[model samples]
Target: MNPKVRNLSTEVLSDNWYILRKVTFEWQKKNGEWQKQSREAYDRGNGATILLYNNTSKTVILTRQFRIPTYVNGNESGMLIEACAGLLDKDNPEDCIKRETEEETGYHINQVHKVFEAYMSPGSVTEILYFFVAEYTKDQKVTEGGGVTDEEDIDVLELDFSKAMKMAQNGEIKDGKTIMLLQYAQINQLIKYN
Candidate 1:
């Protein structure tokens, strides 16, 4: 909170799984005038995401699942291809990403590298997402991970790294987090193959 900004009032709109609130505030402009405003924020908590890659095979693992919000917003089937990600309920970013990777993609990757963090939708959502990448081998897989339970119904995809990047370029992979991770791989030269 800055001294120039005064939080006048706040009203909670919902608090089921997360929280949504409307905040009214007054801002002291540099010109010394007071300006008032109100805005709504949806806080679903922070989250973590990881991209799993196989350097030997030059492939990457991803998941496709039905997203209700996307479906309502013009996506036909609503199935989005995305990197393994989850909300950090009570764990640190690294631990949360590890658990999400295993549960969503069936790969128990142990050694992971953090790339960076970003606010995906900072305008209205108060979620800071941690981005990570991990190298995986065939021996690391422990389960047929289509998600933990039947409700998740995840569809795992192991595609060529080049092809994945192309999909990101050609409008196939629409998820922002997944695109950012894939681009990070390309930009950082993090993945190498035969």
Candidate 2:
């Protein structure tokens, strides 16, 4: 319903893994001229991510996994340290994140605070990610979480809050969502750093 756009058309390019489509449309520029444009967008559905922090222990939970995309893009190991996250496959954002957290981190947390929502990549990917934060305790560790699926080989790590921040600063943690949540924790004083 954008007044500046019209004659929109989309053609599916690939549907093997997820949906990818070529979108063509006419957009009216500020000069009142209509310009035709086309762009390919990958639709992987929306997802949610959470940062699990322990204020008492001054620690946070993270996961390490091998990502094929990063491996192809110059990451030598292809292994990435990131927060627990998953796509919202027919569930609400809150429920999806909770399930992902338990499956990926082994912490069955009941309370979560939604921090924000953002589009991780807008130009080529159409995924709006929901961000969240939750407090964790030692008793919450119910399992040795390494992901439930065969395709997901994840390593869960518990590190000091300051060390986690340093990892993000030094590029050890390259995941955008994980960095953002760490920054959010620092900005909001979620954990005290000595």
Candidate 3:
């Protein structure tokens, strides 16, 4: 059955580096009754995020940074391990992912294997994140990779596949996106398991 949409309205909630918009809509029930609901959302476009791995070296490139939300939410250190990701601004997913990988890790990937597109938080936010995996080598040079001043203070972390998997299992790596990427890599045999 098709969903009957009605009374749709959108309101701007916040506009910064990313804009948040609140959307409301109504639907008709099977009995022909109208039901209304609202959701607050933000869209940074369908951005691309990458899980970069050096298969030869068995290393996965990640970033560690203090997250304000995490800190406020009772995390002692608030440092989060995450895959390199950024919002897509007038660029395609492939280009965005490549650029983000370079900006965050300074690795220029020759080939990026598409993993899957996922919604970070569909119930509230409208962020559709594209996940990818790229192979790199140790010869690749890395630049200082923190975001701009307003969002700075990121530290690049390189970990072996085994260690990364262990960290995830032990709850040291708690970021959803990063967890998803690691699981994808493991399930697809992109990262060798002991």
Kindly list the per-residue Cα lDDT of model 3 for residues 116-180, writing each as its tens digit.
89888888767789889988786665666666557667788899988999999999999999999
lDDT of 1 by residue, 137-186 (tens): 99999988888766899999999999999999998899999999999998
Lowest summed-lDDT stretch of 10 residues in model 2? 185-194
Task: Provide the lDDT at 134 for model 2.
Answer: 100
The residue-level lDDT of candidate 2 at 15 comes to: 100
Off by over 4 Å in 3: 1-3, 148-150
TM-score of 2: 0.98
Better of 1 and 3 by TM-score: 1
lDDT of each: 0.92, 0.97, 0.84
Collision count for each candidate, in order? 0, 0, 0
Ranking by TM-score: 2, 1, 3
- Model 1 error, position 134 (Å): 0.5
* C-alpha RMSD of each candidate structure in angstroms: 1.3, 0.8, 2.2
The model with the greater lDDT, 1 or 3, is 1
